[model samples]
Target: MEINVIEKIENPLLNRTEIHFDCTYQGEATPKVLDVKNRLVATLNVDKNLLVVHNLKPSYGEGKANGYAKLYDSEENLNKIEMDHVVMKNKEATKEEKEEAE
Candidate 1:
């Protein structure tokens, strides 16, 4: 999978940077949120704990996907600004990953 950052908007009030990006995976299935999040972290050179992937949706029958993510300046702002489930979603590992680790 390849990631290309499309846009970045800084929100000082929220203490976060909102990112819009595109993902291209010609032969692979839609990438998982965690997988994309990991890539974003590396690409942005930020701590994984500070990033939250809000959405990732594949285009109909297309090898491309578009998504939105946010990078908070701190974890405190992240927990305060984001929904509880969303924060948990990013923190928890996938079930398949857990099974594989066993």
Candidate 2:
């Protein structure tokens, strides 16, 4: 899965910026919020003002199928990023797997 920032929004109350990503899944099963457990890799602006988070540790909410990601700042405030379900490839194969098959 590769995530690319599509947009960003600044929150007045939290004083943090939330980045929306164009999430794409090339795995077998559709990428769900549950699958993001400890697998989230913040590629862009991680060290800057924006702090990306996943699975809201300590209180893993009801394992919803369509749960989005969140962001925070140095103060530990939270901001929500609305994620939309995009195109997914069901029969994609990995490089190692393809090599072994051949």
Error of 1 at 19 (Å): 0.2
Tens-digit per-residue lDDT, 7-102, candidate 1: 999999999999999999998999989999999988989999999999998998889999999999999999999999888878866799899999
State in Å the error of residue 61, model 1.
0.7
Native-vs-model 1 lDDT?
0.93
Model 1, residue 85: C-alpha shift (Å): 1.5
Error of 1 at 20 (Å): 0.3
Off by over 4 Å in 1: 94-102
Q: How high is the CA lDDT of each candidate model?
A: 0.93, 0.42
Q: What is the C-alpha RMSD of each candidate to the true structure, in Å?
A: 2.7, 12.6
Clashing pairs in 2: none
Q: Considering every candidate listed, which one attains the maximal TM-score?
A: 1
Error of 1 at 8 (Å): 0.6
- Runs of candidate 2 with Cα error greater than 4 angstroms are 32-41, 45-68, 79-102
